[model samples]
Target: MRILRCLKRTPGIGIFSHNKSLIQLKAYIDSDWATCPKTRKSITGFSVYLGESLISWKSKKQQTISRSSSEVEYRALPATTCEIQWITYLLHYLHIQHQQPALLYCDNQVAIQIAHNQVFHE
Candidate 1:
């Protein structure tokens, strides 16, 4: 079975008052390649949050073997986007003010194209 992992705990705070406002939250996502010894496929994952609170995260293996690193990263986009949408919905439910368009970062160009163009990779 493929596994999806997400980091939930907030970081960067050693000791702070609850009354203090959190200015920002940073999420770092990576994969575990050691688990699948046979396939050696990297396990991809992502995280989402709002101001010092972890709202969402996910880590999972690729459904199919990717020919190259770009393909693996491209496959991870949909999953990441789904998490982002979920976090956005949660923010809306909590009535947190935010900008109209949310900014997403990706190192892969193919993955970005896949998210923007529906006809891509079809």
Candidate 2:
């Protein structure tokens, strides 16, 4: 596509570190609850950062409509987690070892709590 060609011509965003010290990978995930007025679907977004450098990010509308804000945020997490996992694997294959236990940040406190709980709720 035209946009892809334009992107290929442009320089990519990157950071150069002189020391090349070990840095932890962190991801922040969020969702816009019912952002689509017509479809009533949530928009999920997440950005992964290695220290201060931006690594990966994506924003897309969900296929299924979420009933609550908590549900919307929760739905966004799995994709973000998968992305981080893939990145981690790639780093390992490249002989790069990062800090253990990558941190994931989410805005919704209720969703975070619910994710940790084992009790099922309807």
Candidate 3:
């Protein structure tokens, strides 16, 4: 199985304070299959942030093989979108005003098209 190196951060490591409130966030999701001796299925992983602060992270094996890189990325979208929606709602519920239509950055054009086109899934 071919593995793709999806580095979450730049090479330099740094320390951060934990007591501060998180303001901004970023996320990265990727997959790897090279080390697994059994099923040989790739694993998907993600890292999340709060402002400049690291908040949450995850890594897991995919339930099945993705047909392409775009497919793998597509599979990751709903999960990320749900997280964004939850965060947005939380901010709103707390009376924190945020700019509308929160920005989501994705590299897959097909995934972006699918997100904008309601009929694609049908």
Candidate 4:
């Protein structure tokens, strides 16, 4: 109740906060590997943004177990990718154009290596 009251007083990000003209969509993804002790499944979370505007975000527990933190982080990538694609499609339908490829931000080095094809296996 106290937290809710505090949240109510704070204003959310407006449609156009810092950049008003155009918003280049990007995303950030993270996961807590083996967060659930019983199932050993991870908790995946992602946030989607249009330039500086936060358009969407969610966090949920995954159903599958992962052997490594990188594996769990890798699993989170596809969901984030799907979100980026969907947002891109919506932008296109709205006739908005952005030159940059959707940027993905993450922390796991092994997952980044795999994404760049720098390493075959962990």
If scored against the real structure, what TM-score would every candidate get? Answer: 0.61, 0.82, 0.57, 0.79
lDDT by residue (1-122, candidate 2, tens digit) is 23235546774833454465447789999899999989999999999876666778899999999899999998888899998898888778869777667889999998999889889855
Q: Give the residue spans of candidate 1 off by over 4 A.
A: 1-35, 113-119
1-122, model 1: which lDDT tens digit per residue? 01112222334433332445453433444544334679867788877554555555677876676666666776676677666676666657868656645545667776567667767364
lDDT of 3 by residue, 17-113 (tens): 3655445556766655433568655666666554665545667777876666667666777777677667666657768564435445667687677
lDDT of 3 at 56: 53
The 0-to-1 C-alpha lDDT of every candidate, in the order given, reads 0.58, 0.83, 0.60, 0.82
> 77 in model 2: Cα distance from truth in Å?
1.0
- In model 2, which runs have C-alpha deviations exceeding 4 angstroms? 1-15, 18-22, 120-122
Residue pairs with backbone atoms closer than 3 Å in model 4 (clashes):
none
| Backbone clashes (count) for model 4 | 0
Alpha-carbon runs more than 4 Å astray in model 3: 1-25, 33-37, 107-118
Going through the candidates in the order shown, the clash numbers are: 2, 0, 1, 0
Q: Is candidate 1 or candidate 2 better by lDDT?
A: 2
Model 4, 1-122: lDDT tens per residue? 23235446774722455755456788999999999878888999999988887777889998788999999999898889998898888779869789888899989998887887854554
